[model samples]
Target: MDPQTDSQAADGGRVLIDHAHEGHFGARLRAAREARGYTIEACGQALRLPVRLIRQLEAGEYGGIDYQVYLSGYLTKYGRHVGVDEEAIQAELARLAPRQRQPDLVVTGGVSHSRYLLERYVTAATYVVLTAIIVVPMVWLGVRGTLDRDMPRLAPLDASPVAQQDAPATSSTSAAAVASATQPQAATPAETRPEDQQPVLASMAMFPPLDHSAARTPLATSAAAPAAAATGQGGHELTLNLPSASWVEVTDATGQRLEYGILPAGTQKSYHSDSTLDVRIGNAGGAQATLDGQAVQLDGFRRANVARFRVDIRDGKAAPVSY
Candidate 1:
């Protein structure tokens, strides 16, 4: 092929020609550098670029440069320094660089697929089944336990035939004693005999007649008594007053639990016991106590905000005993 000359504007607006046989940009750049009698090192020094970078640029090896913009800038500087046209350098760079193809976009509605919906339904069903497996037996056991706890137990019946046969005889003897007690003048002359009177007296002593009139007296007396007197069978009474939330437990000497659990603010409660009473107060600073209507100071007995003491009946009076 005949040597081709590519003419391009250079530095100082001068025109230059590449006399290389091959019309490639790298060969033309090398030819231009030779025409200007400039070595790669001298050209790099003049353009403030590395010698290796100038060689790569002249050889059209642009892979060492990261971005196209940087490569374009370096090429423009190097070409202008060596009397090569910037437009020609840019055109050569565009031809050598790989083209970037934009991906095609497919638009769709924002609805979920049937398979995804089915998967979600299956997951929900699995969760429900798992929950039922865990919760159903627990609920059944709780209900069964509640039924067992609430169900009343019946007392065993007396099935002995001798006891059943004797019940009527005992009732008849009681009726006879009641009749004799109601009418003392209904005795016959034979019953008035000393020997006969003794058996009747023994029977009356064995089966006492039920007096319905005297039964009302005890009920009337209990109703007339104070409410405290009814619950406090033991002569001693203990009163507790709470100004704030606290826990109190009271037990009598008989090991009977009189009061227990958390008491709300402004709560007043009383307990009665015949013997010594055990008392425990949680949050002692908030509680006030009285034994037999006498104030019992809880502050001295308090330790770690808890007060534990005992109320003892001494000399017919209630007094606090602390530990």
Candidate 2:
């Protein structure tokens, strides 16, 4: 609703300088809120913003898609609350805010269905795969055991010795029993092959082969091993990008200064280290960070007014070091 203009003295009377630039919009907001005797909380309550975000805005910390794109509206609301010139604030912000926040939704929104499926199901499928690896082999082995112990072994009637053949003058029931003992029937086509001293169950090929050692590995355990390997020292890089202006500081574990400067809007900088990196950002709203080429959360940086944290890579494991 309202915004900012330069104030000055003309002919000993207070005058609002129309076209003058008042540097750091944050300072303008802070001065106006203070002049009204309103705490940051009271101003935020009136403006419907969290107290921390109000503090960040007053500190000139705006970053990220949410912050940068919506910041103009926030400024308008803030202007209304403080009774500044809305039109003037919008004009200044138009000149100040970069177009980086208006991300191309069409480009990023086109996520491949295959990739989406992989992301959703890959982890769950690992458990199923690991389970099948263990269970399938056990099932096949149990089947083999039943085939060996329960299934009758059959030999041709001619395979019997001459003495046993000559001694058979049995009754009809005994003859039928003898015939059954000599002849075996197969229940399924999988077991229909003749077994006359050939290899045990000539076709165990119906079941998939099992990898005993691989089956023993739990999916969680195997996945953890790779994560640890990823964390080891060497080739660790910390990158910071500021879509909007923010104050930042960085130091290494060896206490070597890397970056201790105010980042201008719409620029990026990086530092390399072998151990840990300590980072402090005065304005965290739109800051993005990467550690070892992986996106890492700024962890309460944006809303906290100022964010400070440490990143550590040890024994092939990368983790945040809490401050």
Candidate 3:
């Protein structure tokens, strides 16, 4: 850099002496010290300089302070306290200061402005990755929610009288039918059935007769076989007619029990019955039945006429139920 042209303009061409000339920064420093009535030693004490060095600086000698930075600091402090034109002096110093450019050296040492740019890019990429990590699962959950809304519901295992009774067969047959229906085949045009297509068989089938009353085989004591057990012998029989929104329970001497329910008018498969060794029914009403020749008690929370009955069996016949 060259000497400051601006200082020339500001100070009306009476530029402070440069430190390199015979009477430069030292002469100006000496003039400031003398004006303040500071001897060389007094100037050294004020600015923390050695008397010999201060004399050397006053003579405009070089190489006293190895670093120009220390000279600048010393000049700034002395100039400020002495009420010099600090700005003009600083401008002159800036013009005279050594250049600090190292752009080529930075590149040669395997570090460059490009490295700073790449680090910024990597930071941006990391932020994008973190945002993706946070968002993907939430998006997945949203899509899953939408899918669930559109999907058909699975029937519960204990849904109804018919559903509970046919649960295993229904599942197996449905799986087989699904498999068969999906088999690869030629497309066939829709065809009209004959006007006199034979009537399809009803799904109902006869319950195989029980050979012995005490038999515990599944075929003998299934939900379908309960009616047959009542028909044959050796078990108590009770009839309960439950009103809508009601339930019924029946317990035998052996602690074996059964429960039944009736739901609202529009609900499908609303009736339920299950066999249990002990039974209690709640949240139902309006029931009636005979129990060992006495009336069973009735209790309820909603609509009435629900029945609870216990049976007594002797010689394989239903005894009158009792409460």
Candidate 4:
């Protein structure tokens, strides 16, 4: 052969060898992946690519994805994951120049596509339901708390009419007893005849009218009124004053609840108990108490801004006992 012919034959032989060496790059990758016991899905997951993308790549189809830098990177990663040499994959990618196809479109009647859509909608609806279940009760409880805090104060019950009518008569009789006891006795007579004293005693017993003005004297009445009012008719009076809003509970000795609930700022309440009063105060620092006109010191009994104590009434005197 001549020199030019020999050079042309050498070039043709080199081209053929290169084409043979780079033959079926995708097929080689698939064989390598399978030999390593990796499924297409596993290889896709390992390389962080979609299963469809992995399938298209192994089938030697370069559709759906951008073919420039992205395809090269994906192939390099997938080849490395499947134990294929990176440099060989890159060289094949450069030489093959795979043709690009149009991206696959979703068909309306496709089963897998419909299932995927349904799953996404179901997941979103589940999230919404869970959020409502968590948030709705919290909102309702908050509103209920606000309404309770702003509730109106209830009026105390009225006293019986019988007690009201008898109060004045009892006070007047007590005053007469006090007046008679305080008055001095007249000097006793030196001598008396039984016959003469009998007529005077008989006449006095028949008439039996005493002076009302003397018995109900202003001095005696004034002294008795305060003593009667301080210790109420059937019980001792207890007064509670709140400087700020606080919760209060009062129970009598009979286990009857007298007052129970929150008291607003500047609120004053009175309770009557014949034997004892059990009291609990929330926000102790803002509350003041009085029993039978005597101030009760609550600071000593406070714990965590709450105070609990019992009031005992004996012989018309009130004393507090801490609990």
Candidate number with greatest TM-score: 1
lDDT of 2 by residue, 286-313 (tens): 6888876788687654334566788877
Worst 10 residues of 3 by lDDT: 186-195
- The CA lDDT at 54 in model 1 is 83
What is the C-alpha local distance difference test score of each model? 0.62, 0.58, 0.45, 0.62
TM-score of each candidate?
Answer: 0.33, 0.27, 0.31, 0.29
Q: What does candidate 4's lDDT look like per residue over 102-200, in tens digits?
A: 579976865698899999999999999999999999999999877656544221111112123333454656766576557635212212211232111
lDDT of 4 at 152: 41
lDDT of 1 by residue, 1-323 (tens): 31221233223433333324123766778889999999988888888899999888767666677776677678778777877887777665554344323458999867569978999999999999999999999999999887766544321111122122333444656778677668877744434332221111011011123353453233233322322322456677788887754556677777886654444445677786778888887667768988878899898888767788988677787788784
Runs of candidate 2 exceeding 4 Å displacement: 1-234, 301-303
- Per-candidate RMSD, Å: 19.1, 41.5, 15.1, 23.5
RMSD of 1: 19.1
Ranking by TM-score: 1, 3, 4, 2
Lowest lDDT sum, 10 consecutive residues, model 2, at 154-163
After superposition, candidate 4 runs with Cα above 4 Å error: 1-233
Q: Per-residue lDDT for 1-323 in model 3, tens only?
A: 33456555677975554444435665777787778877877667877877787677567564557767766776677665555677656864664465223345443456689999999999999999999999999999999887755543321111134233343444565767576457635212111221122221111112223342232233212322223223112233344433332222344344544333222211222112222122233333344434334444544222122223334345654433334
- Candidate 3: count the clashes: 18
lDDT of 1 at 317: 77
